[model samples]
Target: MRSQARQYAQSAQHRRAPPVRYSVAAAAVPIVAMVAAVYPVPMAVVVLAVVAVARYGRAAE
Candidate 1:
């Protein structure tokens, strides 16, 4: 059986994680793939958008 402290650590670790957001977004990858397949988006445009969002998120943090 897990100890109380280990349980507390697990709970805290779950709450503190940032990758949960990434996991949810990752789940939408197939949707993005389908959309991209229907309408071919430029690679440069996608890279620029991702970079812009990353910069914005970092700045907000």
Candidate 2:
């Protein structure tokens, strides 16, 4: 009975694990794009491409 209680506590700990939250970098994408846009279309395109790649890579992982 004591062993079973210990096993139940371990499983409960796993179940209570926190959800993954987005980092500041992940949250800054739109801000980066807006600032990058003031430079030029080519630069904006590059910035957007980089952001997209980063976001997709993160989601894939």
Candidate 3:
């Protein structure tokens, strides 16, 4: 019974964790761009925007 309970707990923990891809550029690039935009860095925003679009677009393909 305790072994079954441990298995269930492990499965639940895995499900609750965010998908690994979200930690990659798919999620990170946009956040960095937003912060750079607030700082009024035109170049950083442009570069970050291009990078994010390309990254997500490729993932969708």
Query: What are the lDDT scores of the predictions, listed in order?
Result: 0.59, 0.61, 0.64
Stretches > 4 Å off in candidate 2 = 1-41
Ranking the candidates on lDDT from highest down gives 3, 2, 1
- Candidate 1 regions off by >4 Å? 1-34
Q: For residues 33-57, what per-residue lDDT tens digits would candidate 3 score against the true structure?
A: 6878688778865786767766766
lDDT tens digits, residues 1-61, model 2? 7699568656865887322333335446666678776765577576777777677657755
Stretches off by above 4 angstroms in model 3 are 1-41
> Which pairs clash in the backbone of model 3?
none
Of candidates 3 and 2, the better by TM-score: 2
| TM-scores, each model vs. reference | 0.45, 0.34, 0.33
Candidate with maximal TM-score: 1
Deviation from truth (RMSD, Å), model 2: 13.3
Candidate 3 minimal-lDDT segment of 10 residues: 17-26
